[model samples]
Target: SGVSCEFEENPCDSEPCLNGGECKGSQEFLHCECSTGYTGERCETKIDSCEPMPCYILGTESCEGESLSYHCKCLPGWEGNGIY
Candidate 1:
């Protein structure tokens, strides 16, 4: 005689997983697995994917995508990679 099931809370704590998604719950269903570059439905959006947009000559330099590999930073003052 010990049965009590009442689950109607803890849905990512209202965080909604955006920009840096990381919400995972299991009561009925609730998912949000976005982070690197971000996505839609909850992770928001900011996808660069580094698909032909790895800062070659735009605004100095800028390309970020930490998941498959991507790194380039050199804008103010200019330096390496930015191609003087």
Candidate 2:
């Protein structure tokens, strides 16, 4: 006796993705969900920390995060850090 395997193409049943995501087949009847700034169906968005933020004030080029938000640290002589 011989054993054989058969594979079927099953599309996603329910689309539970956000931010322009696509529905693809996964292990179960669920999709791999993808989100903005990410590719593939598994919602693997890459966060680039080097990106510039508008909260930075003059003389300051970057900002740092505290707990739940971020704050700008202006250089010497600068007025505001733009983060308050």
Candidate 3:
């Protein structure tokens, strides 16, 4: 007969990585590394890692960049709103 340990160990408690980051061990001490766009001990934070791009209206020529997006340029003469 053998005794089984009922309590499981917290994987993150170990010094898994040398960079002082949380570890997710499978084969190695630290399997997955967190990106700069993510935070938290488990990297639960999500960040926008992409730069804003310019948006142009279907028929227009005007264009602008936004925080996470861009504006559209209106077409030649027909215009109601820059965005359709």
Best by TM-score: 2
Misplaced by over 4 Å in model 3 are: 1-58
Listed in order, each prediction's TM-score against the native is: 0.28, 0.35, 0.26
Please report how far candidate 2 places residue 66 from its true position, in Å.
Answer: 8.4
Note the residue pairs that clash in candidate 1.
Answer: none
Candidate with the greatest lDDT versus the true structure: 1
Residue pairs in collision within model 3:
57-72, 57-73, 59-75, 60-73, 60-74, 60-75
Q: Which segments of candidate 2 are over 4 A away from where they belong?
A: 7-45, 65-69, 81-84
Question: For residues 12-73, could you state the per-residue lDDT of candidate 3 as single tens digits?
Answer: 55554433345677422445366555555555655432233234335656655433444566
lDDT of 1: 0.69
The 10 consecutive residues of candidate 1 with the worst lDDT sum are 1-10
**Residue 70 of model 3: what lDDT?**
47
Sorted on lDDT, best first, the list reads: 1, 2, 3
- lDDT per prediction? 0.69, 0.55, 0.49
Provide the lDDT at 34 for model 1.
92
Per-residue lDDT over 13-69 for candidate 2, one digit per residue giving the tens place of the 0 to 100 score: 445555567776654566655554555445555443334464644577567754335
